[model samples]
Target: MSNSPTLGYLIPQFPGQTHIFFWREILALERMGINVALFSTRPPPPGLISHVWSDEAMKRTEYLGNMDPRRAAKATLGVSPALWAKDVLREGRVLAKDLAIASAAAQKLKESCAARGIQHVHAHSCARSALVALLAQQLGGPTYSLTLHGPLSDYGPGQRLKWRHAKFATVITEKLRKELPELLGEDQPEKIFVQPMGVDVNALIRDVPYHPHQSPQQLRIFACGRLNIVKGHQDLMAAIRLLRDKGIDVRLDIAGEDDDGGSGYRKELENRITELDLQDHVALLGAISAEEVRRYLLSAHVFTLASWHEPLGVAYMEAMSCEVPTIGTNAGGVPELIRDGIDGLLVEPKSPDALANAIMLLARNPKDAQRLGQAGRTRIIERFNCEKGAELIAREALDLRVSEEI
Candidate 1:
């Protein structure tokens, strides 16, 4: 363990309700004899920090948002004027205020890595965190890499500069990996690996065997994701309505809050629920801890999310790990995770009737439901678990190239 390389792990927000995958990967890295030094731009808003391990994670993470002005000034002045001006142009699409903050964060990161003797930093996002890592490396900090969780557009501008400078990059889906060559052209990183995010299969198992709903009455369905229009919570609600009209007594519990605690898009969903007269059938449980999500998955007969687009759904992986028959839309990288009519089911995005029919099919056939549930857990164990992802990261981070492909 003493000889293991100490790697800087950077995240935009260290510990939030939806960041369990990051925590899992960190743990996996540590278990494999890699020392992980946690770094973050800032803490998440108080309401968004719902994980039980959040307090411990926050304690380990060094926040760089609040830097001493004198130190920040010195670090900013230390960079070559020509390089600074070039970066300013490289980041034309980014806000001026955000660039200033990223500069300060880079300074803090440079000093921290020097003091800690970290040789490499890997950012879990390609957003401003990647920019900060880029700046830090420019300031003579540790060499850095990046992981792309979603589309390049979601990460804002300077894609060419970030990818061109990073030691390597990993994407959560092959589809995204394939897009990089066309987007970055000749500016692509030297190493770009396709590695999907994964769940902790050992922790997400069911205590008892799963059985399908015996009766149509009180058939419970569960969904977990942010309350955003892109996540398609409204479409799922409409599907619940469609199921209700067919004389099937069903209940849906959505377990996530809007971006601003509950003030933002939750109001829109509450109004829509009222408009559809689904007050009794659907409940918004707000942001929940991972254990609570597991409990919900264990109790529910079906787990589904109607996201209009998802990069790669960790939520779906978690449900499948819990042996709950899962359903997802054929959007983004979800098809790579779920093979239709095999491990689980996939429907077209934004179709409420399609969602309703899939739910009904599982509700009617208990035997097929059980088969898919068992197969889903097996799929997670064999391929999509977190350990495999961590292995890929370790190999790439340490430059331990093997002749055979991973």
Candidate 2:
């Protein structure tokens, strides 16, 4: 414990609703006696930050997004002009904006690492936070690593620049890891590990045994994810409409808010609920605490998310941890997480008919749903434990002296 170096934990938005996994990993690292210095690009929108621990997380995080003109100039000057030109030409105009943001934070990050005795900076995002870590490492900061949570394209351009000099990196799925070499070509980082983010199985345990809502007419579905077009909430809503049309009363509670709070895409969803005449069947629970989610998971008959594409879903894992039968779309890396018809059910993405059918399969068969729920819980407890995920980060990124018993 005494020999371990402080690890700088970086995430773009520190404690947003979907970031409970990050918080669990931080706690796990601390439990392993690895000191973690939290850093974020900036505070998230006030409306978007909804976890119970968000305030505490914000207090601990050091925001580094504020651009200092003098430090920005020095940081930009430190990079070779030829490399900058090459990056711009290769990656496009987006590289310039990313570089500018990275340059603004680099020197500040370096000073913070030095002051805090942080030996390694691990960026939990492949987006601009990765760029921030890369530039900071270049400016004599701690050695940096990255964890790719989704598709590289989602992170924007400068893939080569981001991965070229990293100490190591982790992708959430083997699919992503296998594709990395082809994507980055010659500039791929040397040490890339496959590590999925996970939820706290211990904390997410159900206090009471799960039983499908006894009413044959009602199917209570619980879903948790950010409100976005890609999450397939609209599809889920359509599926709900289908269920109702088939004479099954479906009640769906979706816990999330749009990136811009309720002012943006949420209105579209709300209107859709009205357009579908699902005023009583659907409720959009804006940005709920993890505890509330756990409560919903405990009470719900089925848990599901219809992501158009998901890179190993933590929301599904969280529900499974609560011994809830989960239905997920067969989108990116999700098959790696759930065994179709065994631990959980998988439906094709954006297919309301498929989703409706899958939901009905569970709704009509309580025994099968219970079996899946039990199997899902066992799967999460054995394989996707958050503590184990944290230990991987500690061992690989922070070089922590973890006990063999772990």
Candidate 3:
């Protein structure tokens, strides 16, 4: 391993699920004696991690100056514009806004590298951060790489131009990798890699085995992810109702942020709980820290996520690492991580009955659930450790750089 290769980690916003996952990988890389630098479009939460470096990656970016006129026109046509035209106009403003930010950040990164005699750049997402990384690469001679995660389809068109300029792009699933060539054209097939997101198996494995079914009266079922449409929390709520109606005393603790900012979904979730009379059974704990999540994982009887499509769920891996059995919707790359019947159960997406039945089966059969959870933890320890992921990515990145230089 070369200690001299400077690896710059770049991201747009630095505190969400993506940032937390990347942070774990960064820590892993650093522990492996790699020189790593971190950059963001905006500063991360204070006191989390010391910045190796920071600066505006770009400047003087222009976006829709005034969208009020457009909103007025749309409103006149009987369209209920979600926000003032300004917000709608600013929707994609991140491209230009981030382009400017990345340019400024890249220049500073180049100077930082020159001072440290650094070598390469890596961005966490193929979104705004990658755009910034691309610009930085143009200004500095460092080779650039990127990891592509969610909002997968929406980013393809806009990211095509930027991706073409990258040294290599890593995606979390083979599903996305297979679609990339068709989406971005067949010419760049060799530049893409299907690298699933990884988990810290050692950190996740607790000293005490997770005590399953904590309450004699209540069956504790847990699901976690951002409270968004893609996660299908609404469907999970419906499944909870179905299980309750079957005379099963089940409790669900859903953890994640309502990033939609007090929108109807949050209210709708509350209203659904009221309508189903599930107020006593379900709890929506918004945005708990990672340490708290591990506790929840250790406490719950079974872990579940009924998402419509997941690139590769870090939460699933976390639960698995904690020896908690998982039941997820069979969509996206979920199957890649979960082996149905062996590690965890896989249910049909959007099917509340299927989900509820799976939950009921596991809840009723403690032995089976324990077997699955134990198997999952073993699988995680053997496969999903951060050291393994970092080594694979680092080796591939170094190879790509060397091949390009030749």
Evaluate all candidate structures by whole-model CA lDDT and list the values in order: 0.88, 0.88, 0.69
Task: List, residue by residue over 54-152, the lDDT tens digit for candidate 1.
Answer: 999999999987867876676678767565456457566353445566888898899999998887899998888987898888889989999999999
Q: Cα deviation in Å at residue 9, candidate 3?
A: 0.4
TM-score of candidate 1 on Cα atoms, chains taken together: 0.95
Q: RMSD, each candidate, Å?
A: 2.5, 1.8, 9.1
Instruction: List residue ranges in candidate 1 displaced over 4 A.
Output: 1-3, 81-97, 400-406
lDDT of 2 by residue, 297-403 (tens): 99899999999999999999999999899999999999999999889999999999999999989888889999999999999988888887788877787565467
Score residue 325 of candidate 1 by CA lDDT.
Answer: 94
Best by TM-score: 2
lDDT of 1: 0.88
Q: Please tell me which model should have the higher TM-score, number 1 or number 2.
A: 2
Better of 1 and 3 by TM-score: 1
The digit string of per-residue lDDT tens for model 3 on 375-399 reads 9988888777766657655776655
The count of residue-pair clashes in candidate 3 stands at 10
